[model samples]
Target: MAVDIRTQGLQKPVSVAEYLFARLYEIGIRSVHGVPGDFNLVALDFLPKAKLKWVGSVNELNAAYAADGYARTNGIGALITTFGVGELSAMNGIAGSFSEHVPVVHIVGCPSTVSQRNGMLLHHTLGNGDFSVFANMSSQVTCELAKLNKPAEIADQIDNALRECWIRSRPVYLMLPTDMVEKKIEGARLDQPIDLSEPPNDPEREDYVVDVVLRYLHAAKNPVMLVDACAIRHRVLGEVRDLIEKTKLPVFVTPMGKGAIDESSPTYGGVYAGTGSQPGVAERVESSDLVLSIGALKSDFNTTGFSYRTSQLKTIDFHSTHCVVRYSEYPGVTMRGVLRKVTERVDVGKLAKQHEVTKVVNEVAENRDSSDTITQAFFWPRVGEYLKENDIVVTETGTANFGIWETKYPRGVTGVTQILWGSIGWSLPAAQGAALAAKDMGVDRRTILFVGDGSFQLTCQEVAVMIRHNLKITIFLIYNEGFTIERFIHGMEAEYNDISRWQYTEVPTVFGASDKQVRKFIVKTKHELEKLLTDKEFNEAGGLQFVELWMPKEDAPRALRITTEVAARNNAKAE
Candidate 1:
């Protein structure tokens, strides 16, 4: 006899706002981050009352970044904002989250259904009559679902939208019109539990891929392994690392996939495409006997628009879609299934490590620490030291763009970064989503954010969300004024590199992040910074601490130093 010990809830119908709000609790959302607007006041009303906190942001872009970062570290990040202006402001961050596959729920407030037909030129309406701009723009980076026309379908629409998010492992949006938030609706009642578990591979297709890949592997002598953000985000690091070890192939991580395997590992060949490339390594990639790109988007940015010619041998680009072999034999099948079958046949451990390849992996790590400032150099190593068991870290496009060169992590943990869609203000709210997801899954993990001052100002309002939910977060604000990275891009020459200086210490107080019991911190120097970061008072969970490091405007940490140096030279040449 077997017993089912499960928690049960009382069944009762709830209004659209109630049901949707309840679903947040069901999915384990503790707080909502973003600015309020007329269109979204319905959900806003119930948020505080129901014990779910609502955080108001100064701007939509930062709110989106906060939500994205919250999700990267916490899971199920939530952001709510008004119509056109707010939604449009959040575009950059939201799109980045979608590209990075960070699970987030963006609740955008829109004009009422009645208003859609009135032709009255609603307050938030764009120059064009179509409201689809919000949905369409988001659709490119991540998928979105919305229906302002149907009041009764609101709850169900939200439920289905979240379900699709689980399936795709990326960001999803649910547009809510101001009038429909409190409308009546029948909540979706599914008898079958939503399975978060991944399904087993297709046997036949699995065998086919393994056989084809095995044939290629056995023939190649100097095959190079390439992996990207997708592999890292899916928590497939171990499996991927296992495949690398089994084949004894040299591994090259993408900027986002830096820590999938310890950057210090003998098999590590540091990141390619973006980060510093070793002297002969870039050429090696070109002349590699076999190139295996697994779970890699091979985004144009990653390969310099696929610039390096690899015509001498072959490329086995393994993706969710059909596999492209040597850019010739394109076959249909899942890459994981292929790996599964291949593992069944080959004794990968017997592949014997390649000495020359191993040498390259070792050489790459030495060049990773490119940051010049000694005190400022703590970015990645400090990040590595702070790594917890399955801890979620949300990094914005700039921080993520530069890549945590000195950062380290365990074999298969999760992190979120906006690589393709370089969105500045996404890390914050995304961390909220990650926290929400973690709490729901009963996982004890802290959310951390590595962001700069110029970007941090964008979504400064999420501090309220942290306060309301009692979510513990450690946020780092490197106070170097202006858009640091953009200064290196050709014409700007630091012209647009300016931001209003604010007391970084006042963020928590201004946003009400400081309740009677919780505390916040602001550290300026190397000594004070290290003590605060390492001290007992600063690390406690549920405390919102801001360590503000005052650096000259020049203290910008570029992930790709080579490119920055080149840009500097180009700027000098022009002058």
Candidate 2:
């Protein structure tokens, strides 16, 4: 027999950057968002060859945020950065992706493997010559980490990390040394598509959990279903809709869970947030004999300071990785499987008649007094009317997050937020990313963003990127002087809560946007807002449109007031 020495598994040769970008393109990443750095410039050159577009951001942090927003809409997104300095700056955005369970592939181009091994001081690294510090920190927030050192192992490592990112619906990290970017790697693995299939559940455990859930589900006289953010993260919104349609049970969403289900469904009740829940929704959810919570994440903001009154014994929680029927837990049973089984097994038509809660009644009249000024009280309801079907709404963490909770979204309107992570200045870049994704996918949808003045200041530079790309986005800039949300939480009159005033309407011009490219409005009165809303040119604009609405510094949404009061009390105790 002839000695087989054909480099083992290597059937063809391709550069490392070529292989990486090819895999990303195969995984539905039409645009790779990031700022180019010295280390990543060479790799960036391969993007065009791979037939991928490079979305150059103003900075690394915004790049990561953009990637996250894209991932939420596009199913998967990828971002690239330079070594330590770049990666560290992008970590906060990565952590937000991790906390909210958005799948993003964070690729970092680093110093050569030889330099890392020899402990040579690199420009992006700390002067002490420790390059491993940043990677270790990233491991905490990422689901998986891969450092490409050997050519033979690089292809497998890349595939594994990207697979984990898709399967878990969370961010993953990949380090590509500068020298490795051009090195030839085996191309045979590229022929096989990345396996993103969810792991098979043990049949016995799946059957047991589903049966137990059905037993509790069918026995109760009054039952409710709560759909949450994880449902969106896990890409099971259709199955959730099926569960609702099949069971005919009243459905409600958590704060973070908003937009995961069709708000227009006849059985759709309202949002549930303990005391913060819509009228009668809390009573129904807490007092029900059985509550089926699918993909529920009971974070602080989602639960209204842990004020939920639902008894655990009456709850059957279906999580991403497991199912919990009261106190009994099934580890291998997933929400996806349980949802399918429930839709197939449950006899929803024969179940007892349940009271159907009407859709959220808008108390604000369509026609208000023209002389009245715009208030937080009047602003949100009007916004509800402005929303259209299939709009991708992005909200900032501060006032926008809480304020949007009260606004009733139309059917097919999807929501994006970082509520659990509570990061300010997140929505701006996120809007850009989402807009790019929507355009890239040929999906006809408008990207609307609600952000505060203070938060906007943090990442305002991304405005240029949006203008450069000519992305169609509508921005509602809530100008309340400073960090109104923070002041409400603590330091009501402190100087630390204040921010320098800027010409909010002139921001587009300052950021390289022309008058024709961006439609700008400064409205301090309700009449002006209403007129602007009705303007045909403003409504049908093909480019960016901005509205700066002025409100009192002390005013806030009802839910935000409640949450801030509790947070302030907690902070007082610490002091």
Candidate 3:
């Protein structure tokens, strides 16, 4: 009963691998990342025909992490891995992408369909002849799953999986068997690009939600807009910005939502994370009569251990899937449409007039100690001074992540972090991916990474990949002994929280870069860092630059101290 696709199609045929790669190219994935394996060896041959570049990574986990970062910057990304061992190695990275709402396509080159039907034992298999185990495990982390075993249905499955990955902004699992890679499918379907648009909201429900938002907006004497991580993930920055500009409401961002708004704007307020917020930010947000929370993910870290003082009755939440005005929920009405409609119809005069804006100065007191040691308070704001507009700043989930709250970003800068997932070793490889993505997009932006000693040691081998690709990135290796964040959370003097130190500034050279291709510096004092930050040649370096920033082991960011204290209490609390 199978109808051959060749007779049904009016045009030429292409191999399944060719069709899949072509689809990936059309969706703006210029670079595919993964480690090469025997199962995926033949399929990797079709990359060039589709104009895709295979970025050979050091390991599958780093490759998946890079893909996640690339997807965040380049709109969509993909990675290829072998079955069983290779796929399982990338699962942690995939789960992080899922938790963070980044769209990444995970393609696994599995054993042949024939091998599965005949119950033949394979090397990567469990030796029990069960081929469904890995796919079943991947189903837990991905939004869509596509098994391309049947030739006639392959094209639709590929397109559908990709479409869902884009719309939902989460990872998707695609299983490509070794034998099916060469199976012929219709090539004419490649002419039409995959429809990547989100489904439109129902007209009636959307209108009602917009009206309700407007009514509350006009009635409130004091209202504020709180932007969060999903605003960037869901591709609604334009709508959010339009609403912000038209209404001129006091805008604040959560820790996870950092860099979503232009911090240079007059309406921009500082970050508000309950008691961990900047000066006057908590009072301003908690006192507002109406809080328009956009795309909020109130994770424990994001909320500073759930310390938010604002009442839900006073909050109107706007999300990717639904809208809530106060306590009234309007399902199926997305924020993008509602934000657009409200921006187009908002009455600026009816909204409360702006009071004298209190400018929150984040500058810390200068180091008064005679040792001239760089403290966390002094280092972060100094980093803020060194940052340029449009730069992509990557922070590791340790002190770098918590310290960044005090470093206000310039206009157009994109902040990347794993605040919700709290993955320790994500920033280094992620920076590599972000830099490659920026280059692929042809944007003139510096890729900067701030990673602690412990996190850098986990994925430092990715520096070789960056060197091989000749990517321009600035990496500030914060040497504060060991896992400072974990030490603050528990076991301040415990041996388990310690790590051996490395001579970090020599990494680029060790990674096989020439002297001219790398610049290295070690700063142990405040004056040394300031001099390097102001140097024109160092700031505008042509190749990879490494800076080792030495700081006191006991010193931690104020927000980190607060959040860790709360976490320690929660961990020790009796059930």
Candidate 4:
């Protein structure tokens, strides 16, 4: 029943690898991130020939992590890995990207189709002759999975999988056999671009949802607006901001939704996380008569151990694909569509302004001297002073993740963290990818990474990749002795929560960085950090820089401490 693609095409045939990379290049993927393996070597050779830069990473896991960072910044990103071991190693990173709604294409070069048909044992295989195990595992995490079985269907399969990735904002898997990489296929399809546009909204459904939202807004007193992570993921930040401006209501952002809105806005309230929220934020938000929550994700950590006290009956929730007004749910009513309508038609002048809540103030006090020991209380605020406009801030899970919430990000700065998945050691490689993405987009921005010593040890080698590519990245290494977050979660004094110590500042040198090009610092006191932040020459330096700041092992941010206590109690009850 399959129609032959060769019969109707007039153009000359192209290799499947060439065709795939060409399609990726046409669609804005300028670089491919991954490590080389035997199975993928044949396809990797076609990278530069396709006009795509081959960005080699330290490991497949870091490769995938880098690709995720790239995708979020560049709109779409890709990585290539080999069969079995290589692909399996990258699964965790891909899963994180899927959880966070990043668009990434995972192209896996697998064994040749001939070997699979003949049941030949391969070194990377499980020896039982089963080759589909990894792809099956990937299907659970990816939005779509395409295995190139027939040469004629190769182009169609590749194109379809990429389209799904763009539409869903999640990772997709494409498996290419070694022999199939060079198989002849029609090149005429290259002339036609893959449609990446979204389908038009259903007017009736959109109108109904928008009208329902407006009715709730008009009828209630003490109305409040809340923004979450989906506002950024679904590409509706501008619309959300417009709605906030038009309504002129008190607005607050969740921890996951940090940096999506201008925190400097007059109506901007502080972060709202129940008990973990900034002072007076929880009281104002929980007491609201009407809560209009957009792109809300009620994760335990995001909501401070499910601490949101807002009544569901008084809330209207907007999601990426649906709208929920109390108990009634309207499917196919996208938040993007609803926001557009609300921004265009709503008149906020008729709405009354209620008593204003005090703004959450998180400015850091100036350090007295260098001899003063650094603590989480003082360190976060000091780091805030170092931030500049348009900086892409990346934070690792654990202490750095929770600590950064205490620091107010500067205007024009964007924050990236894997809060939902809580993956450790993600920001290091992600910084490399983000820096590269910024460079590719021609955006002059610094990519800053905040990572704990324990987390840095997991994927520290990625710094070498950053250096090799001359990525403009500044790394702040928290030199707390061990796994501080785990200690707060369950075992406060347990030795099992500890990790081995290393010479943190010597990392860049060990990673093949030269002395003149790389700047390294180890600061134990508050004075050193302040001096470094104020140094114009150090701040304007190109290439890589590393700073090791020593803090107490048992110390953590106030929000982290509160959330962990709640988490501990929840865990005890579950057990």
Looking at model 4, residue 112 earns an lDDT score of 90
**Residues 215-237 of candidate 4: C-alpha lDDT, one tens digit per residue:** 88877889898998887777788
**Per-residue CA lDDT of candidate 2, range 274-336, in tens?**
876766777778888998888888887887777789998999988888888999888878888
lDDT of each: 0.63, 0.87, 0.91, 0.86
Off-target runs (Cα >4 Å) in candidate 4 are 1-8, 354-357, 366-371
Which portions of model 3 show Cα errors greater than 4 Å? Answer: 1-10, 364-371
lDDT of 1: 0.63
Steric clashes per prediction: 34, 0, 0, 1
Per-model TM-score on C-alpha atoms: 0.77, 0.97, 0.98, 0.96
Expressed as tens digits, the lDDT of each residue in 1-575 for candidate 3 is 99765656647689999999999998899999999898899999999999999999999999998998888889989999999999999999999999999999999998889998997988988999899999999999999999999988999999999999999999999999999998888889998889998899998889888898899899998899999999999999999999988988999999989999999899988898997887599999999999999999999899899999999889999999998887889888999999999999999989889775565647755533566789898888778888999999999998989899989799999999999987889999899999999989988789999999999999999999899899989999999899999999988899998998787888888889898888889999988987999999888857799999999998999899999999999999997
The candidate 2 region of ten consecutive residues with least summed lDDT is 1-10
Q: 3 or 4: which has the higher TM-score? A: 3
Ranking of candidates on lDDT, top first = 3, 2, 4, 1
